[model samples]
Target: MTDMPPLILWFRRDLRLADNPMLAEAAQTGCPLLPVFVLDPETESLGAAARWRLGEALVAFSQALAAKGLRLHLARGAAGEVLERLARATGASGLWWGRLYDAPAVARDSAVKARLRGLGIEAKSFPGHLLHEPFGIQTSGGGGYRVFTPFWNAIRARDPGPARPGPARLRGWDGDPGAGERLADWRLGQAMRRGAAVVARHALIGETAARDRLHDFLHGPVADYPARRDRLDRRACSGLSEPLAWGEIGPREIWHAARSVMEGAQDPGVDSGSDSGAAAFLRQLGWRDFAWHLLYHFPQMGARNWRAEWDAFPWRGDSAEAEAWRRGRTGEPVVDAAMRELYATGRMHNRARMIVASYLTKHLLTDWRLGLDWFADCLTDWDPAANALNWQWVAGSGPDAAPFFRIFNPQSQAQKFDPEGRYRDHWLKGVGADDFYAAAPLRWRLDPAAPPPVPLIGLAEGRARALAAWNAGKA
Candidate 1:
């Protein structure tokens, strides 16, 4: 073993190697690299689905590191303490890591940096999780942009540069690394009730798999994205959200892929379709960037409304109706199908997400936080900034939020999007296959063997009530 002190690379959400900024920069330093991952409180507290996904991702990442002749040392406890102990034990010279946007993460990372600097061990953080650092963006007035259009326009216009390639091979610290906890002991999956078995089958892990999926979409399905992104019955989406959230893939990589298609670069992955489709799909990464932008500037959005005036807006506290909404028992075919899809596969279509969020916040008059937490528990791709921001956007409580006066009629939404009950037939078990095809032109074709759940509240009544509350608050 070499006597030289190693530079520690602490893995957090940015789990993958390729396109990882911290890994790339550290490799350039030519220091012996020691890889470590800490399962601290914030990580430990993730909802069941997220925890389950993280566990699977870690297993894949560990194997990926092993292939590079490296080990991802796992430790449990406060991250600062764990890193300090590990550094002292190993005679490490410094620590390097990627940044996280959430309030808790920022606090923890700041504290860790200060402590390490105090000890004269270098600690540096890099940007790998997002195309732009949340704090780096600002308006002409030097304040955060509360509007998304301008935010997107500004970020989209600026170049993010290319993603750095992962090291061809890593020089792992040739030292006596101490015992770190086995991944199995974490039990991140056991907290889940629907059984992580289902989510595991659905999740696509590892960086290579994520990159291949991006390439496949750029080649074939992306051309249809503009015309059919909201079609619930079709496979027009990239399905890269979870990997993006887990940092298995970077946004710059996806941005580059879509930009390549837009630029007329022909590859095996590009289908004969419109470049406009590729350009439209690239907006998703922009939205992800805007989510973090909002979170960093308005951290209170985590538990409160972005528009504080809406705080007094009445919401149904805890009730059987809310429980039904959460369980896919709301008797609304589109909403039920979406919730069930989330529970069974750990994901739902993007269109379905908006529909279900509308049903919970406006139709049932439930608080947006309930829907947000349930999603956090059920979605493999659960991202703090996006999930919170989107839930509030649908609830009419966030920046550039949908107007409270506007409500999605699930019946009409499914009709316009699902059209032929194709998506409903596959997911909604309430109706007999025959009845579903034969039912009225729109939703609820199924003759649920069990009586279709009665509507928790009449949509008209709920909509009217929500409007009254919102109007009163405004008045």
Candidate 2:
């Protein structure tokens, strides 16, 4: 048995050990495992904030592996070439990894698998990133769903099964695998510049931290999620987006935990009122799945308009107004506060996200792709599928999108969601403002005491302009 070649485990977005199907199956083989992570071209192309966050996830995952008496070998280059070199060097006979659905990953993985198998090396991909396979659920016509409600109905009752527990012990491959790059040398956070330090203050890294967060949310705040999830002043929403984005926590674990609360199986302290909230929270998760489904079925979704007719609509490109919006100087209190929050914390409340996105697309009449690109660069919790889908949805450019006439009045939105102005004042004039200035690039020359800028366009004026354009485009 000692003479047997090792099996290579490639780590990508699925970084955790527990509830990880790939890791659990690999452990059952009782063979020495060579864990590796490759910084391939696809990964290198991630946005600055996402790249920096990946580095944090890698650090935490490395620590977790060390605790289990295993080592994660770091490599750089094209994934296929890197994996082949490591396999040849280590005499690895097989390789396994969790599957990813994004177009780039799918293409890369397919090519890698074909090339590796030509050498007679065993390669396998497992499903754990998403709750269900993207193509698994379909309409009666055997086609993918376009609307979310029917998609939600199709999957809401199906059980994803219990979460898998991590292996207690694992055998590591003996001897050095190959020459590897040090994580520090990679400088994944180089693009982040000064913003890294500020965002770190709000980040909850590592698998353990993610699990603890899930527990805390389910035990208390989840009960109010139904009513307060959109309230900017309340902490009623789960802060699991970052964890979920990095695969620090699997969705099935969250699903089961929430189910336990809903069924009164795990926590008796949760009142019956929580049932509605738990159910509502589950629907949000379904939305996450639906986003991926749309992405899988429509690979160009992130780059092109899902509805081809949208191409005819006139969308303004980059300009002074757009720059002001990005810098949180648009003079709209709620909008500025949200943008500032994104700069300071690498995250903005869900309601804030919609408001800012609406203000940019409908009020400023700017292209949605610009806002999407900015978010890709700024958000630590960025998911390619979700970001693109949500942007298109708000812009009324995608399937089942909101109507173009449905513009968000930021002032009215502030009154409804942030009535006391606590959310706005905190991010605009309080500690959040201080953090924003600290994180802002030195070149921006932002002043903490500066009064908010005057509104770029009047609400009614912008609304009329947008409607006229929309009507013209339709005609």
Candidate 3:
């Protein structure tokens, strides 16, 4: 090995080793590597379920590193300070990490880069977090695209290049890397309380698990994904969202894998519809990218309405109805089932998500932010951009949003998606219902035998009220 100083490889959401741009580049340097994970203010601000899931990711990642004869050093503090101190302590010459696009992360990373460069450290950010850089794709006017269809069209054919493989070998720093915090001391899951155990039963942790999930998806469910994805009672989805959220898997890897199936490189049985299913799955990935793109262009998406005119709309805040919605006692079978699914498993079906968001923002007339915050706290698969974008899409407050007047009738939706009521019955009266009760906090006093709640408002009345408010805002 060369006598060069160690290079500090900071880990963020990009936790996996395979197809990781930063790790691949660092391995090519032939210099000693110091892999570190800092629990800075930005990370500390994560919601309860997300935070708890993050801790599990870190554990699995650390174990993966150990198998590769490397260690993941843990630290807690402001990122710039902690990184600078670590660099000085380890005699490191450079710092590298994958990029994040949320407003807070963007602001913090910019400051960190500036501070590190001031000290003569080679600070760099890579593009593994997303298939493409958020700012890289643009419209003819050199501005970000406000609409998603055009954004998807722009990127659909353009190649993102091949996903890189993990380094064959890693050279670790030999000297004292300096003082580090224990992962247990952080207590990342403390906020999750009683629900952690329930959610854990559903999570597929680490990179290996993520890769296996992708393989399994491409080989089976993907064939029928296009037709059955919205069927709430069927296991027709990829189930990769939680892994994708924590960077246990990279988007490019998923993209290329799906593309391979689309190109017929892998036989997905005799299903001729597999091609269409793969295409549909790829579009969902594109939607994830689109969310980040919108967030990059409009940082206020999470907190404010994307359409300024939406400010005039009357959105009720915390009340009994909103609380009932949170507790999954809305009396709308589909809506309650969806909410309870979130409580028990820390994830909601995509169709269920849209229904519940529409019910809250349009039917219950509650602010979309309320639902957004609840999802943030409860969803293991929670992504900042996706969460904000989807909520706004349902609320008709964001770019390319569904019209506000298109309120979903929960009973009608239940009939269409959960036609057999298997999904509703599962969460409301079956095993899922038991999990929800076990997971619920004691203070909520949720009884397993309690009857379903009454409707917060009549569907027609709520729709009319929402339409009246929408019309008034237009006027």
Candidate 4:
């Protein structure tokens, strides 16, 4: 090992080494690098699916490092304490990590940085997780972008540099790199129960898989992404959510690769936006950036309504109805199918997510938090900023929120989006019609011949009730 004090590359959400600004920075110092991942308190608090998938990713990450003649050390405890201990034991000089934006993470990182600095250690954070840091972009007024379009435009105005390549080798670790707890002992995957079996069939793990998936999508799916993304039955969207959430890939890599694809597709005669599908898909990524923008500005936005006035809006606390929603027995085909899809795969199509969130908040009149918490527990791709912002957006209680009065009629949504009812046919296969009606109120079971299931509340009735509650809250 080199006599120079090594730099500790602390791994968190930014898991991949490629396009990793910190790793690249640390490599330049020619100091040995010690990579470590800690299952700290905040990480422990992650919802079930998130934790399980994280454990799986950690193993993949370690292997990826090993292929390059390095080992990812694992430890468990408070991150600051664990890092301090590791730094002492490993003789590390400085620390580097990709930055995180959520409130809890900000607090944790701030404290750790301060502690390390006081001890004559250098602690630095870099950008890899997002192209534009949440707080970095601002409107002309120097405030967070509450509206997404302007946010996208403003960020686009700035020149985000080209993406960097992955490091060749990380030379460090005088002792055993696997000197911490065994991954199996963590038992993170055990949280999934039966859901694990279902999600495993669809999961794409690690950096290579992420890159391959992106390549495959750009080759074909991006050709039709603009019109096909909303089709729940179609695989037109980049199913990169899980990997993106776990930081197996970074946004800059995605952004540049997409730009390159579009540019390559353009012969001199073709316009830049000719690949409308790729452009539209990239806009969705902008939405992810928008989510962080809101969260960074309003840290409390996750657990509470962003439009605080909505706090007075009456939310029905019906455990039975909410339970039915959770179980995918709500008697609404589209809504039920979406919930079942989420349960079975720990993922829901974006359109399905909007429909169910709307149904939960507007039709059933439950708190958005209920649905948000449930998604947090179950979604393999569950992102804190995306999930929170979206739930609140659909609930009409977020920045630039959808109108609360614009309640989605599930049957109509299913007809329009899942025209053939293919989504329902797939997810609702084993679920009988009568089984759905059993969860509904007795009066709702009016059409036995039409379909065995009937809605728990009529759409018209639900709309009227929701509007009255909204008007009352405003008054």
The whole-model lDDT of each prediction reads 0.84, 0.90, 0.90, 0.82
* lDDT, candidate 4, 1-475, per-residue tens: 3566668889999888788888887877777778889999899998887888898899899998888777788899999999888887767788888998999999999999998998888899998888788888877889888998788777653545656888876776566443688888988977775456556766778999999999999899988887888898788899998999999988888888887787787622112333386677777888898998899899998998898788888887758889878877688888888887777677889999999999889888999999999999988888999999999999999998999989988888888889998888776764433333333234433344444356788888988888888888877
Candidate 2, residues 118-227, lDDT tens digits: the string is 88899999988888889898999997999998888788778876579778988887767867789999999999898999999999898999999999999899888888
A best-first ranking of the candidates according to their lDDT comes to 3, 2, 1, 4
lDDT of 2: 0.90
TM-score of each: 0.93, 0.97, 0.97, 0.93
Off by over 4 Å in 2: 265-275
Model 1 has an lDDT value of 0.84
| Candidates in order: C-alpha RMSD to true structure | 5.0, 2.2, 2.3, 4.4
User: Which segments of model 3 are wrong by more than 4 Å?
Assistant: 1-3, 265-275
Tens digit of lDDT per residue, candidate 1, span 415-438?
Answer: 999999788767675332332233
Off by over 4 Å in 4: 176-178, 267-275, 430-454
Q: What is the lDDT of residue 428 in candidate 3?
A: 91
Candidate 3 backbone clash number? 0
Model 2, position 192: C-alpha lDDT score:
87
